[model samples]
Structure formats: structure tokens, C-alpha cells
Target chain A: MNISLQTRLLLLMSVALAIGVLVTQQAGRYESRRTAAADIDARLGRVAHTLLLSWQVSNDLTVASIPALTVAPPAPDGKRLPVFEVTTFDNRVLLRSHDFPLRTHALRAAGPGYGNAEIENTRWRVFTVIDSQRRIICRVALNEHDRSLREATLAPHFDQPLLLGVPLILVLGWMSLVYGLRPLRRLSRELARRDATDLAPIRSVDNDAIVEIRALRRTLDGLFERLRHAVNAQRLFTAAAGHELRTPLAGLRTQIEVAQRAPDAQQQTHALERIARAGEHMEKLVSRLLHLARLDSGETEIARHTLDFAALVARISGDYARVACDGVDRPAELQGDASLLEALVTNLLDNACRHAPTDTPVEVTLAHHDHWLTLHVRDHGPGLPEADRARAFDVFYRGENTFGEGSGLGLALVRAIARAHGGHAGIDPPSRDGLCVTVRLPAAHRS
Target chain B: MRILLIEDDPILGDGLQVGLQQAGYSVDWLADGALAADALANDEFDAVILDLALPSRSGRQLLADWRDAGQTVPILVLTAYDALDDRIDGLDGGADDYLVKPVALEELAARLRALVRRSQGQADNCLRWDGIEFNRASGILSIDGQVLDLSAHERQIITALLERPGQTLTREQLASRLYGWDGGPESNSLEVHIHNLRRKLGRQRIKTVRGLGYRMAQPDR
Candidate 1:
């Protein structure tokens, strides 16, 4: 069941050639039989003519009655011979060969041309003719077994070619296939030799490869390139996440030390406040890091369903008092993964609320345009500078003047989830001092 | 002693500044590397505590630049990158000492004291004189067999003098060590602390030259 390509191809070709040889063998047998039949008819008619001529020279019925004059004798045995019977119009027998049937009317059903009848336990091809000038009827026949001997002669022509050519062609085909697949074998060997951490692009063993093999090499190289990039990205993310945690951890340690050495309740209370804030920030960072890591693993399936976008955003908005949902009352439906879409909305809203002014509310709007649904979230805080906006979607990329305690993963997760749903996320720099993020998804509502 | 604290994290920087100040140091904290480099060049500090990752500039780059400029202050690298390569590169790039993050306050203080002491040509954290013993780590001064209580200024004066046993320090240099750039007692108030140290450690312990500064008295021949 797990046959290699070479063996499979060889087996298929061998079967096809065998069938072809069998069909050709049948055709050869049929043609040999036909040709033998035709030859037998001609020979029988010639023998009958010769007998008539020999009889005409004598003009004596007794002389023509000689069995040797009638036909050649059976060779070495009675297995084969040309047998005949000369009869008058009144059904009187004039001459009968030794091999002629004893029973009367045994071959009478035979027509004048050529026909077959059994005589003396041997099937015969019979040719009968009436010599009008001689006032006699001549009947000639030879055993049908002779045609089989002729059939044997054709074996050398048909059987030899098939017997020899099949194996030869098969061998040639096998050799060509092996030669063609050599490049693939080399490619697999090269791949098998590599260590897991080696993401270097593979060099095909030879440049004499076919088009398909070359294409396969290019695809494998491209895949390795992508794997290398993903590995590097993972390394950088781990490093950033670890570095980001150090300060908070350091803050916790120093705060505890300060509290332990506090001289008064006031000093202790202040240290405790900083410790509480730092602990909360660390918790936020760790949870966001988990989300980013899961997304990076590329295993999360986007479970698609027809869900109302307006209700989902409204639900996420209601969780935070500072976020307001706009144009989400009636219903706007789209086909998307429910959980992933919810996360995308939540991240956008969280990002907006984090950066928004303390007094102002974050705004969310959903709009549908031709097969596309766009969601926009705006904040009235000091907008991201022109420089920091481009790399906002990069993991762990934060502006120097970023707002308080944003894990820098919120916008990155937003972009990731949106892209997972066959969409894109972008930024629109507002004229006023604010930032707005927009996400677009394909619209597939119910008919 | 005065210290320059260069770190970018808000809470960590705040905590370190407070902790070092509590350890009897005047700490000048800067959150940016470019600003820190400028401050280091234009000012003086007994030692420096630097974070490797900083905005606008990196601590390693600043260290290399400072070393290239022949700035001779002791620098202690405090970073979260615990890789051996990062440590090697930081040290080879002219850092006087290196430490990983989440360090204990006591350890940081001890290392800072050691760096500062070694940079000043003192062998260790302890300074010995004629019948007087000064311990930097414990911040305690003892004469013969008795512990002598001293004010913060008196301690600063004795520490500066003990580090440079025979060398003299100008009034401004001593004031900078005690109070960094912004605050200290009035200009002439340094003499008061010097006089008090001389009294506490015995008059033979400190000598003052006219129109110059103060130095620890050499041991009697």
C-alpha cells in the first residue's frame, strides 16, 4: 500500500505490456488460421485439377483408379493425406482414394467450394468440383490438422518479439525512471542529514534536476526561510518579555525593602502603593504575553460562524465604562470566528481606553461597505507620534512616550486576530490630538 | 558620597534612587542615555549605577563613548540580560562591574561601595588610620576600642579624607561628594564638619592648610 513511485510505475507498465502481448498473441493466432485456410483451399483445387489432367491423358477409368495417381500418400502414417472420390452424375462411384470415407454421403453436405467434414476420425477441409467435360465430379480434401502446423510457424514472428521486447522495454523504462528520480533522492538525503536547529536553505545535489524538482527545492527553501524568521521572532519576543519583567520584579524587590525599612506608617503606605501598582502591571504583562505566544504558535483555529458584530463589540464595550459603542443597536452580522473576533474587539477597546484622556470616553463605530465590514476605535489622548504609528503592530513595539502600563501587545494582538479573520488593521492619524485604529473584515451575512 | 543613577524604568529608577539615598548617598537620576552621558561629562560622581537598555541611547554605547573620552569614574552595569555574552560584552566594553536585575539592595550597596573604594585606590571597604577605623559598608567609625557617633556631614568629611590619606580636597570637591549638585549646607559650613571630624578623631587625625582644603594627618613618624 505504501509502494514507492518507481515500483508502482514499473508494475503498472509491466501489467499493461503483458495485456498488450496477450492481445497481440490472440491476433497472431487468428491471422495464422485464416491464412492457412486460404492456402488449403487453393492446394485442394490444384490437386483436383492435376487428377483431372492425369485422367484425361489415359482415357481409361481403370488407370485413373490407381490410388497413387489419385493423390500423394499419407506421410509415414494415415494421419494426413489428400483424399478424394470420383462419382458419376447418377451417384455411381468411379474412383475412391484409400483415405476416402467408407460411409456413403458422409461429405455430401459439403458445398462445391470449400467446407469441412469429419472423415476417418479426422476433420478435413474439402473442395469439390464437377468436371463437365470429363462427365465426372471430383472431391478433394486435406486434414484440418495441417493448419495448426502452419500456426506454429507464426510463433517465431509474434512470440519472439513480445517475449524479448517486453522485458527489454520494461528494463529500459525502469532505468529511465530511476535516472529521473535521482534528484529527488538526493534532495531527501540532504534534508535527512540536517539537524533540527539548522534552518539553512538546502542546496539541491545537482543542477541537472527537472523543472518539478527545482520548483520543489525552491518551495522547501522558502519554507526554511520562513521557519528561520519565525524562530528569530520567537527569540526576540522571549528576550523582550523577559527584559520587560525585570523592572517590575526589581520594583517589587526594592519596594519590599523600602517598606521593611520604613520608619513610619506613611512611608510604609507609600511603598505598599507602589508595590501594588507594580504587581498589577506585572500580571497584565504576563497575561498579554501568553496571548501573544499562543497566537505565534499558529495552531489556533479560526472557528467561523455567522455572528452579529454589533452585539459583540457592545458586550466588550459595556465591560468598561470609559468605552462607548456607536451604531451598534440594531444588528450588523458577519461571518467570523466568534472568540477571535471578540478578542480583537476587546484588544482595540482596551488599547483605546488605556490611551484616552481620563475625562473622555473611547468611541467605537462599525460600518459596512460592499462585502467589507470596518470597525473603528478612537481615543482622545495625545496621539501616537507620526514615527511610532507604523510599527505599532510589531510585537513588543512601544513608543518612547507610551501611556501607563500598556503591555505593547494589545495592538499587535488586534492586528493578528484581524488578519486571522481575513482582514487588516490600520491607523488613521486624526487632525486633533487623538488616535484611531481601523479594522476591516470580509462581510458574509445571511441571504 | 554622590552617585549618578542612569535607568529608564520609572518604578525601578524611583526605588533605586530612594534606596541609594537611604544608604547615605546623594543620587542624581537620569532616565535617558544621551542626557546621562552629558550629565556624567559635565558633573562629578563617586560612582555610577547604569541600566544597559535606555531610550535615545543604549548604556553600552554610552559606556564605550565615556571610556573613549577618558572619563575615569567607576560604572556598575545593572541589566536584565543574563546571557554570558551580554555580560562579557558589557565588561569588555569598559564597565567596572556588572549585575543582573532583581538584585538585593544590600548587594547593590555593597558592590557600589567596593567599586567606589577600589576606584579611589583603597584596597577594600575599610579604611584604617592612626587609632581610627572606618568601615564603608557599615558606615561606622571607631577610635581605638570605642565607637564614635558622627553626624552625616562629619561622616562625609571623614570618608573623603580617609580615601585620600595624604592628598588634599578643595572645599567644593568635599561639598560635591556630600551633597551632589543641588543641595548641601551653606558654602562655609564645610569647615564646621571638618573641625568636628578633627575633634572626634583627635586633632592629630586631620590637618588643614591655609587657603587650601583638608587631608587626613599622616601617621606620626
Candidate 2:
């Protein structure tokens, strides 16, 4: 399940809001219940005190049948209205002023103070007082409806402020969250609507909130830069290849044309020779292109094995001896890909053969020191100019004196392969009378 | 010389046939690798010019087959793919030489001659004509016991021209042979050198073929 960023963030905010609201409601409810309990207890204490005062004043009224004391008529609207049965201290019911429901559960046996008890599914707060002079106990009790513990605890939460305000607060919280997240939402929408090539930075109103977004934009920009570079490199390579190819192709065509216009055997034969030379040039160019492409794309895997460099050089020397006026030195043994190494060696040897005088013998030497393998091919031919030396490593940067049928990617490809194997190629000043090329490879096997 | 031309393109094959026959070689051309292979099996030819791309078998494969069958006739492989690997592969597969497409006929015959001579392992390195014996090994010119004082570059150029006497040498060929790689005579350099050599020897010794190149003509009797 892949969740989008918005959905995950919204869910997190919603859960946090819900928990906050519920916790506030629960806390408010608990505080209200505590205050209500305290209110009821205080009211019971006051009622008990009032009843004790009334009993003390009645202590002198015991003569002549107690002269039916006219108790003040109950004022039903008064705040202090009391409802209770009067009883004697000696456990005798004196007067039942009102037939109170739940009379047996009233304050009759309660000792001069407030008490609580449940009677018939209802709870009551009862108060009792004792007058020693009159020897009477007066008790007062009230139905615990309005001032009841459960109602006092539960009522206010349903009243105007809390009941209405909680929902209002929750709605406000949600709206605020939505407003706060607008920038992120806009960024996402803008990103979604863009094409693959549009790698511009996101426009944001709140700069403080989008540090990560800026970092992400930087990363994307880097990727785009690299992609553009790769595309440019490929374009340049193709254009160079095409341009280089035209020379040989044109030569081949002109050779054929020349032959077609030839009036005699001698002329035709000469044209044919030129055509053959052009063909050879084309062949060299093509092979170099393939080798360079293979190296660049990493398509060529190394077949590494312990190679007897001496034997390989000897074989190459023997092969080229008929045409090579220059002699190649014996090579040393090392571990490397035989085919790639052969290419490297052959290219250098062939280059020397092409440049040197027919009578001059090129010298080749191979040696190993520590973990490094080195091979040197030197031609007594004119050495590369110092100015052109660096450019010589660049593809197609043929020297001014180089007139051979070559692709000019020889040294470039050799360098690429050597670098890939954690080695390097260099042009050393000739110890003798020619230009020398040095190839060095690290001893470690690089796959 | 009898030549077997193996090429796929009819226009190129036809052009080559006309050009080669005009150059005095008896030409037998095959349009595909299969036909070339079949012809090679059924008939004997002095030399074979094979094209790399063919219908059934490629020129490289055909050359390999011929060599494997112990055919000692020199095979020159022609290809449109002018890559180094292609050239090396063609050569490695038993081709005596490799050539790119759109070649001139005269150069082709000269190369054929060289290949034939190489195959026969001829000892003489000199082409003798007009009382001049050009020693290819020593890079010296001797005419009736008189040694020509030629510059190294001039000697190399005259030697190449002398190798194929009476034939036009393209500017590209002369430049490549003289300058080591085709750096070409920079700023009328080849013309200047040729002029100097002509003054030393004789103007009639080397003739210029207009718009084509320089050629060492046979003795004008």
C-alpha cells in the first residue's frame, strides 16, 4: 500500500486532534463532578446548623400540652425551604410534617449531621440536629434531584458553553491544519502537473517550512544536469564519428571514380591501389569506434588471466616482422585480460610501425616493478610536438605529422581501458632517437 | 591476371568489371558470397577480390573457408565497415589484404600485383625500366651506373612511382607513402619536392597526369 504524503499527514493530524478533544472533555467532566460533590456537602452542613438553632429556642415551650406550636407556614418559594419529619431524641416520632417519600431512609437515625444514603433507586442528602434543652432531635432531608451528585456532575457539560464550544474548537483545529498545509499541497500539485523535463524549483510562500523541499529540488537539479551532460557527450561522439568517417568514404568513392575514368591499365591499377588504401583506413576507423564504444558503455567484460607478456609480444613481433622495420622488445608476465591487452599492445606497435622510417627499427620494452606492469613502444620517427601531446589523448586529435590510415581514437581508447582497470597511459621522452609510449597497469586484478 | 570479384552490389560489381577488364585483367565476377564460394570450388583463379557483406556467407567467412581448403590464391577482402576490428578480423580470417569500398581500379590492380609477388616470395626488390633500376631496400635510384642523389622523402616518393611505372599515382597515395601517414604535402610541398627531383634527374623522367597525380612514365622512345 503506497500512501501519498497528503493522506498520511492528514491522518496523523486528525488522530492527534481527536485525542486532544477527548482529553479536554474528560478533564472538564471530572472537575465538574468534584465541584458538585463539594456543593452538596456544604449545603447539608448549613441545614444541620439551622435545625440545631431552632431546637434550642423551643426548649422552654414544654408547659400545658406544649401549646400546639404553630410552625411557620412553609414558604414554597423561599431558598431555605425545608422538608423533614420532627422526631424526639428518645427514638419516638414527634410529628411527620409532610409525608416524605422515603421516610424510613431519611435522617431519623443520623447523628446530628449530614449523611448520604440511597433509598428506592434515589439518593438523598439528609441533615439531623439535637437540642439538649428541649431534648428533641430535628431532621431535614431533600430529594437529591437538582443538587444531586450525578446531575451536578453531568449537567454543565451539556449546557451552552462546553457542549457547543468543543465542536467549534475541533472544527477550528481542522481548518487551521488545512490552512497550514496549503503550501505543501500547492507544491505537490505543481510537481504532479509538470512534465519530466521541468526540473525547476517549487515556488513556496512560507520559506521557513520548506527546507526539505529545497534539498529535494537541489537533488533533482543535479540529476537533470548529469542527464544533460550524458546527452551532450553522446551527440558530440556521434558527430565526430560521422565527420571522421567521411574522409575515408570520400577517398574510396574518388578512387572508384578515378578508376572509371582511367584510359589505360596503368591508370586503373593505380586507382585500385588508392582504393585499397582508403579501404584500410575505413577498416581502422571502424574498429577504433567499436572499441571506444565498448569501453565507454562497459559492455566489454575482462577475461582476466595470468598472461605471459613476453610470449604475447613475441607473437606480435613475429606477426609484424615482415612489415616492421622496428624491432619490439620482449615483454614481462602479468595478470590481465589477454584480448584487451593484445589490442593495447597491437595498437601501439602498429602506430609505431606507421610513423617510423622503413629502415628504422622501433624498440619495445616491458618490465614490472612492485605491483605495476609497464610496456614501452618507441619509434625512431619524429616525436609528437609538445603542444600536441595532451591533445593526442583526445579522440581524433591526430598530430600534424601523422598521415597514416588511422581512426585517431587509438590512444584515447587505450587510456580509457587503462583507467577502467585502475591504471594510466603516458608518453615518455624517447631514451633513444624516437617517441616512446608507456602503459602502466596496477598489479591487482580489476574486474 | 585472372581475377574473381565477389561483390553484392550490382552497380559496383558492374563498374569494377568494366574498369578491371579495361585494365587488362580477365575478370569473373560473382554477385554473392555463395556464388563466389561455389566458383572458387569449381574453378581456379589467379586472385580473388571478396566483399565482406554477402547473401549466404560473408567475405571473411568465405576467405577463411578458401584458406582452410588450402587455396593459396591471395584473397583481398573488401568491406563498407571500415572499422579497425573489421580490418583485423578480415586479415585474421586468412584474407591476404583488406580494402574499403569505392576503390579505383588501377590501384586495385597494383595491390593485386604486390599481393601476388608477396605470395610468390620474389627476391628482387627493384622495378627495372628505362635503364633505371630502383632499389626498394636501399631507397636508391641507379640509371646506367649513375646513382641519383635524392632526398629521403624524394627517394621514397620516386620508389613508389617506379614500383608501378607508367601508372598515375593519386595525391593521397603519394602523400601517404612519402609522409609516413597521409599528412599530405603541406602547402604544395609534394609539388616542390617533385620539381626539385625533376630538375636533378630530367623533366621527362617523371610525368604529371593532370588532375589525377604524378606518374613515372615508361621510356618515351
Candidate 3:
């Protein structure tokens, strides 16, 4: 499933905290048990010393009334108590406690130390003390089970902190997660409440402590800014296009109305001529609009094939041979979309025809050097100023002081078509009293 | 019929003027919305064909101003805004009818006729007086079962008289209907057309009151 970031972080923390609690609890138990056993052994050694001093003062080795040894009180439940034995070097037991378990084997006579023995199924901690001058041995042992019982009495003390700490950690972890994710939730809510057409940037909240979230908000704001500009540009273009289309349509309607009510053949012919011109203008506008839209959408699939660039130029030039002259230096070949290339050439020639003087001949030239194949179209028209050269290829941008009527989409479409073939188009610096537009493409490999 | 045309575009304004004039409407074209408003306040027109986009003042603003001033002239809105909301706005803004641009000239004329007829409390396309029936659409007059051929000027005079039968029409009113403000009446042009009209329909069909003007003679049912 898709777990949220907060849940994932909480889950990881919970697992780590669980392991910490378990390890701490076990170590507490082990250390407390060891310290308790050591404490018991020290108390037993002190008691044995007192008993030895009494025996030395009396100067008697025979069995007699033994002094009452002050021992630890019995387990609270009265199950077991501290036990002891006094024995000689010859394996004879001289003294013993009332509760000491009877054993069949003789107690091993050894140096004074601490050890463990199992008299029955129960285990015990044994401490031994010896008086070598008197040949007396004193051994004291306590039930291991009793020590565990005492440790258990202190169990709640250790457990209370852990029991309280674990839940506190979980609650604190969950609360922190909720608090930390507040900014993201606020951003989502803000986005959801906005209108579909509202392209305004999301306002960033001040005092956001998380750097990553702040960065994310900045990135989103940047994206929204770009989208708003694009949307505004598109809206302006559509509005302008609507106004442009209405002008021609209005003209066409007026001309047709005039034609319908013309009084004579001469007037009818004049009206018919205007109507035809308006229709042709509308047709050209519509076709250019379609081409520009296709290019803007970036979805036109280009079918590329290897074709002779010089021959293609020659063929295209033939269509405009009456007004345009061609110069093809050598046979240049290129791989590109044929229809798009033809459109590009046609748009260039048409643009020249519309702008250039009727007497001047438009020039078309093609040359290839190294991997680059270039096509150039020069027109003897009122060339664009240096500032307008860059913007002239923008959609619907008309040049200053241009001749004849045009849609203003031809040069833009030419640039788009050229770019689609992995090429570039630009206005070359004029070497004479004319304007030259050049398109450069990568030449196809001979193989 | 007199019409006030408020349009900014010169070509469209000229074309509409010509076409509407040919359709027998005396059109007073105004290129600016403020001028149109001023003219509307001072002049009497049967209907108005208003363009939404205009110079000096927008058409919508002028319409609002006119309606606020209690002008009840039937208005037909002409605009290039073909969206549904634009039509709704135009109608809700007190326009009697709405037409998108590039509308057929015949349709425009018909719509104007319908608007004028409705203003005059007319229900059908034919106006009848006695045995004569006038078809508003074709501008043709028929008596009994026979159609009468009439000149454009004679047709205008008969249409004006037939619109309100039994009511006396002043000579000035009849002259204004026959020729627009620009065309001055000749000394006996109205008399000539009236004579022609009376000769074609019987002389008893029209009665000239002693100094008032003319009225259609009512025939007994």
C-alpha cells in the first residue's frame, strides 16, 4: 500500500524504541541481581567472622550451646531463609542452622570464598570462612530463589518508568508528525479551493521552518508563474485571432450583400471581385491558423526521408519561377519531412512575393559545406530594422512598412517547420539593399 | 419605417445603410455610440439596429443609459460576439432581439419588420382594409382576388394609409413616409402618387378630409 511519509517515519521510530525498551529492561534485571548477590555474600562473611571470634575466646572445640546467629529475615512469603554450617578439617560437622538442608556428601574443606550449591532442586549462594589456627570452617549459603524473590519485589519500580515512557514516546511521535505535516495540508487545501481558471501563484506562508517544504513551495510557485504567462499569451492570441477573423468575415458578408443587390452588370462584377478577394484572404488565414496551431501543439509527426535538397529547391522554385530566381551550386541532400520542407519553401516565397516590389526578382540559393546544408531566400523589399528582425518570426507579428496584405504567420510557420527538421532559421545581415533569410540543416550521410 | 443604425465600422455601416435603404427603411446611421444616444433622445425612429462595439461609448453602456431614460424603442443588437452568454447579456440588457454578425441581409430586414410590427401591436404579416390586403413581407397589395401593380412610391403611400385605416393621415406625415428627411417633396409629387393610387384602387377607396389629409375608406362588412 501507499503509506504516508508521517506513518512511515512513525513506524520506523516505534520499532527502534521497542528494541531500546527491551534491551534496557533486561540489563536492569541482570545488574540488579548481581549487586544483590554481592550484598548478601558480604553480610554472610561478616557473620562468620563474629562466630569465629566467639569460638576462639571460649577455647572449646567440643559441641555445646552455639550462639544465635542474627540472619536475614525469612522471605516475606515464609518459603526459605539464610542457612549455615560449621565443620572441622576431618569432615565432621560441628554446628548447623535449623533450616539447613541435609547433604550426603561431606562439605569440601577449602579456603574461605564464595560459591553456589544445590542442596535440593533449589539453588543457593554459598560463602565460606575458615580459622586455620583453630582448624574450624564456617560456610553460609542463601537460596538463589529467595534472592530472585527479593529482586521481584523491586520489579514495579523499574517497570513504571518504561511503561510511562513508551506511550509518551508514541504519543509525542504522532503529535510531532501531525504538526510537521501541517504546511503540506494547508498547501493542498489552498490548491483545492482555487477556481480552475485561477492561475495566480500560491502565496507562501511566512515562518515555515522546514527547508525542504519551503523549497517545494518555491518550485510550485515558479511553475504556476510560467503556466500563468503561457495561459495569458494563449488568451491574447485567441482574442486577436477572433478579431482578425471577424474583419474578413464581415468584409465578405458586406461584399456578398452588395453583389446580391447590385443594380447593373458593372456593379455586380465589382462586388463579385471584392467578394472573391475577401474569400481568398479568409481561406489563407484559416490555413495559416491551422498550420500555426499544429506547430504550437508540438504534435505534428514528421516523416523524414533522404531527399536531394537542390532538386527539392528547384522543384519548389518552379512554382514561383515567374517572380523568383534560383541558384543551386551543387547537389545537396538532406533527411527531412518532405511536406514540411515544401511548406517552408512555399511560405518563404510567398512572403517575398507579398513584401518585395513587383519589379525586383526574389532570389533562392542552396549550398552545403561540411555537415551543414543552407537555403537562403533574399528579397529586395523594405527590410526589417535590426530590432524587429528577431521578433518578426513570432506568431502574428507584422513588420513595419511592409507591402501588400498578409496573415503575418508565414515567417513564423517557416521558422517552426525549419526547427521541426532539427534546423534553424534567421534573418542574415544584409550585404546589399535587400533582406535575406537563411535556414540551416544537418546534411544526410551519403551511406 | 425609420431605423437608427449604430455601428463603428465604416464599411459595414455603409453596406447596412444601402441594404436597409433598399429594403425601404429610412436609415440614419451613427458611427459613435454617444452620437447615437443623442440622436435617439432627439429623434423618433420605429426601431434601432445597434452594434455592440462602438467608438466614444460602448453599445452596452448606451443601451443601459437609454433604457434608464425610459426610452422604449425596440432595439435589435448586432455584434460579432456569438457566444451564448453574450446573447443572454444583450437580451437581458433590454434588447428586443439579438443577431450575430454575418447575418443574412434578408433575415435582418425580416427581424426588423417583426420588431416594428410587434411594437405596432401587429400579430400577422398581412394588413387588411376593405377588400385590399397588404402582404408586409413582399410589400404587395391585393384587392379581392386581383393583385395591383404599384410603383415603389405608391406602395409606400398605400402602406402608410393601410397601416391605420379610418385614421386621418396629415400631409406632412404622408410626405415624410414617402420620402426620407433628405428627399424634399416636389410641389405635386404626393398628389401625383395619390392620384395614381386612387385610380388603381377606386377613387372611393380613399377619402380626403377637408384640410387634414387622407384616410382609407372603410367598406361595409
Against the true structure, whose TM-score is highest?
1
Per DockQ, what order, best first? 1, 3, 2
Query: Against the correct fold, how does model 1 do in TM-score?
Result: 0.76
Candidate 2, residues B41-119: lDDT per residue as tens digits?
7664557888775654667778878888999988887666677988898888888988876566666877876785576
Distance (Å) between predicted and true CA of B94, model 1? 3.9
Candidate 3 lDDT tens digits, B18-71? 677677767778876667879877776778999887645788998899999999
Worst 10 residues of 1 chain A by lDDT: A70-79
lDDT of 1 by residue, A259-357 (tens): 887768987888888889889879877877876677667677677889988888888888988887788886778887887787788888878876766
Provide the lowest-lDDT 10-residue window in model 3 chain A: A103-112
True contacts kept of 2: 0.13
Count of backbone collisions in candidate 2: 32
lDDT of 1 by residue, B1-221 (tens): 78899987777887887777677777888887778889887887889999987766789889999999999999999998888999999999999999999988889998989899889888878888776788988889998879999886778778877877788888888888877766675877887888787777777667877678877786565
In candidate 2, stretches whose alpha carbon ends up further than 4 angstroms from where it belongs are A1-12, A45-116, A123-209, A318-336, A351-362, A378-392, A399-403, A420-422, A426-436, A442-447, B1-221
Task: Indicate which candidate wins on lDDT.
Answer: 1
- Per model, kept true contacts as a fraction are 0.47, 0.13, 0.20
User: TM-score of A-chain in each prediction?
Assistant: 0.70, 0.69, 0.86
Q: What TM-score would every model get versus the actual structure?
A: 0.76, 0.53, 0.65
Two-way DockQ contest, 1 vs 2, winner: 1
Better model by lDDT, 2 or 3? 3
